[model samples]
Target: EQGHEERKSGTLSEPQEFHSGFIRINPDHPDRVLHQDIDNIENIRSFISAARAAAFSKPVIAIKTGKTAAGALAAEIHTGGKQSSDAVYDALFQRAGMLRVSDLTELFAATQTLAMHPKLLKVEQLTILTNGGGPGVMAVDSLLQSSGKLAQLSEETRAALNKVIPQSDMTSNPVDIFGDSVPARYQQALEILLHAKEVKNLLIIHTPSALAPSEDYALIIAQTLDKLPKMARPYVITNFMGEDAAYAARRLCSNYGIPTYRTPEGAVRAFMHLVSYRRNQKHLTQTPESNADDAKINKHAAKALVNEFLAEQQSYLSTHQASQILAHYGVECIQTEVAYTPTEAKEQAIELGFPVALKLISPSIPSKSEVGGVVLNLNDAQEVEQTAFAMLLRIKNTYPDAIIEGFSLQKMAPRAGANELRIAVKTEPNFGPVILLGEAGTGLEFAQAAVALPPLNMNLAKYLIAAAHDKGVLKERVLPEKVDKYRLCALLTRISQLVIDQPDITSLELNPILASNGQFLVLDATMTLSRYQVQSHRKRLSIRPYPIELVKQVTLKNNTLATLRPIKPEDEQAHQEFDQSLSKEDRYKRFFGELPQFNHDQLAKMTQIDYDREMAFIITQDNATLGVSRVLMDPDKIHAEFAIVVRSNCQGLGLGSLLMRAAIEYCQSQSVQFIEGITLPENTGMIELARKLGFKISRDFEEGSINMVLALTPIDKHG
Candidate 1:
């Protein structure tokens, strides 16, 4: 409607609209232009996420449709198979740093917000200015509904606002200016709110009133907002109530590049788009530690466990077989064994100690508790035998068609009031495996589950755990010590890797995964397999997992055997320690200044990088931090920045040259046009290293740094 009005008034600047969702900026063009349309979405993400790994000056914004049940069905009908291929498209979009907006209103608001204050993506604080109590209340409710917090004014700020508005009216988040408030009152309130150092962003609201000069007040706020310095300005979103009369004011605000919304609720929702976008950008920059250890995953053993069940022509593995599978992957489960006879059950119970559980194993009866086929806490041999026999008799009469094999015996492991969790891997028709971690038990709530498409690493696993716990999905039981999160993250990574390796596994369930004391034990489980397998296993995951194939062991020039591999998420601590070991001078050469201790966010950004567009290689022997090399690719994936540092002790062993060669080769493979770095003029050692590697040396006096570039591959001549 706004565009039509602008077009009618001869002020429409942007005259293009696109059906193609993906966008790009080509240097060959005069300006940005549409290049391609999605003809097919067979491998949806390959196209949906084509721009995810590329480096861009601005964020890649996306619109995801079909999140609702009716919309999903329509999409499936239109697309011919899936409403969406990946169940976790939202997750995929987030990992790629794409800002996903719900509707056109949000798309416009969020774009304007980011355009005005790109740095505010991660800022969460908000302050409000309103002229009416009812509108102020609505604005506060909307912000809270979007999971946003209202910035509390300091005592000094409150006192200042109290002087302008009445004390009774000013004692709140939305410093409510009275209904009869004039332009001066709006001006004073905005000044007080914007200057409060606690404020990260500001929302100015106006509802139509008899005394309130809605249009005049908006122009006043706009002019005041325009005078603020761009560098320090918080993202300001305005809500000028009603339409026709407010159109000119809205246009005036838009002319100044300030975002104005139709409703307060829309404005808050739009602000959250910036919130979610920046949070995801943080997620993108944070991939430094891959947390991938090839030594941890034994593929041979995992395959062997799966094949045994296939050999027996069993589609579903029983609790005993399921426990064996988890055991191979280093996931602890209750010790379980199958007993063929009553005497065998008694012997198994005595061997496992008192208070063991006996469950009747059958093909048809999936849940033992349903058919009276489970016996828990059998204290003695006689009781075990009696319970085992009774369970078999009960299952035999009730489930006549069930193929009863034997009684499965497992120790009744106690959790001692630890958090009981449900971890399951379910497959989609085309998208492959999605892992769900949430509250456990038969009476599970849908709202309490958090889902992610895996292959997961320690960092991603840690994110899932924290998100679930924070959102009230994963709860803690009464326990003195909490469930150790590190161990849980490691275990989750293992489970994710296992599913990635075994393609035929249809579904897996580990209910009541008792988590406590840095240990996890699966109390009960069921794993089903299928003859059908995904053709391309790599495409199974929506987000690519850690690339374990890049890990290698090399002998340094000093004859020291060292492991040279891509940096993992767990390398944050090692990277920090490596930074601390550097001398003040060395740090100046590398970081270009004296360095303070690296904080968690800073260290995470340095270590945790998205493996898609960049690579970091570390050389370590006996887990000691020896040296590190990193190459960060531009959004275009063409230009790259290469940096290397070998600890002072390990210098002059040809390690620095070896790392440079590796980084160059890696960049060439990634189709990077050139690799470059800046060094202090006095850093002769680094300058010499660049010369030996056939790089062109130049001095950027303006930047006060020596610049070097090594072109690996030439650009395409045809274009």
Candidate 2:
């Protein structure tokens, strides 16, 4: 309706609309041409913005159609518009903190489930309680298929269940109370599972039976859950089978704030949806450690080499050139030497050592081993020379016009127990630079690889590693010693920072990066260059990265040096301390009420903010936060709300003025039309600061507050 209003008022500029139910944005809709601007890549990101904004306040259950090739074609034909890569859509939805459901059944099931019990589960494990064995078994199967776990009942819990459940075979995880049991039996079984420390989510399944009605069983479960404090125990979900008999029970469960599904699979899928939603939300808010090793990286040298290749109008960098650039970024690369001729290759091999590897270096032949362009384990100079000569001949004959950059010679890597991991970066039109990691060799591995967008921190890198492990892409075998995951995460993070530091590098591939005994050796690599055009270096990312460029050094009024920068996740502790140091009156004035002690989640929400929609600049000296200024833009991006608070101990240091100025400049840069803030009338310092910053101050005597408004952009008269 809001979208309709905007369209009717001639105010709908973007091809997207967000509301309470769900946002349906089709950039390629045929009507978009008449009603919206030119559809571009930004349309997808605009959808991301809408989804994320909605997700912030409520759970967003999304249904992404056209997953298969046939479905995609059908959608294109029906809508008369092409679809972007489904994988890109998947990544965007995950990044935006939206839970994707497969069909309308799962969609409504998940929506109802989340809408009723919005609290996240403590664990992904589901403890099934069923009167029939078949529905319990079905629920178990669905749970495992969804990559979820079945709650393992402890021996003590099983012993307790044996006392109430009559059948011996039903004493396990999916405790069966027997079909002939009464409603009291279900209440007993539910209480047992509800109090079990191992159970995080409980799903009770019931089929129609003459022994007891489904509504009676649902009432008992509801009453049992109500006995405990709200959200104090594992969440209880119900699978009341059959439409005719289960209809009243389902409605009763809905009124009692319990999720009910018609099928066991639906209930389990809804529970797993909540699990996925929780994980995605964690990824959105988790604060990652800063990459401490980036200072040691030779970004300048890497940029220079990439620039040199771009200056020469060459896209592909030679093997040795690529190795050198990787080395500059602190990625351990096997020493490689380029030779113009076979004799030069032999001489280079001799200089390096015996038992070397020789590969044909040509822009056209990307996969050297595929075209007989590579030879391994050459023992002596003669073997190296002969192999190089034969490889050159084979490649030259295969592609007569292919640019042969000569041969690359390097010592052979010890292949015994080492894992060959492929790490590559590719630029997608929608998401920009994406990082791929998986097992090396063959197109099959490429198909199974896990991908993540760049600008990764330690936490995001760990998530990528975990996701790869979950997908069976990268496995850790006990034989060769465990792969150093921390080192690997650091390396991935460095590679992420490399792209941020040097945007000219359009693509990079490190094939068969050997990982053995906590060591990573880049065996063979390739890089492609393009003169990236961007207003800012990080603009290519679909999700905005931390704005390191905004960090600045400033001096306080007391001549003490301080740093004014965007807040980081690492500042949560300091922010807590800053919040606690404020006097009662100061806190009340700042918060407009008595401030409560912030919990971990609240502190995380304050510190780990999205840089795209919100900006929190803090003035810090040493290890303490002296002051903070935060600006939060609304969904429209035209108006922003501002807040500033200086530490009570450091109130007279001119920090508030500095932070407000910085925030105003930031709002101006973002093109925010108006900046608005309010403060108690007693807060004369803040009101004076607002006046100094060119803000129009208006007093509200009824509300006993002062409203400060600053127009960053000229107001339009036509609106």
Best by TM-score: 2
lDDT of 1 by residue, 307-349 (tens): 8778878888877888777776787778788899988999988
lDDT of 2 by residue, 1-719 (tens): 00111121111343333321123333332221111121233444455555565555556666667778898777667656666566556656677777776776665556555655555667877788998889989998888877888878999899989888877667888888878888777788889888888987889899998977888988888888889887577887788999888888888887777777888987888788889988877766743433538665887888888888788898888668887787776798898999999999999999999889898888787787788877889999999988888887777788888888888888998889887888988777656777888888755223477777666888888888998898789887766577788989989988888877787888888887888889899888888898987643235766666787788899988998999999999899999999898899888888999868889989988998877668999999888999999999875568899999999989888999899998888888887899999999899999998998889999999998999999996432210
lDDT of 2 at 687: 93
For all predicted structures, in order, the TM-scores are: 0.77, 0.90
What is the overall TM-score of model 2 with all chains considered together? 0.90
* C-alpha lDDT of all candidate models, in order: 0.71, 0.77
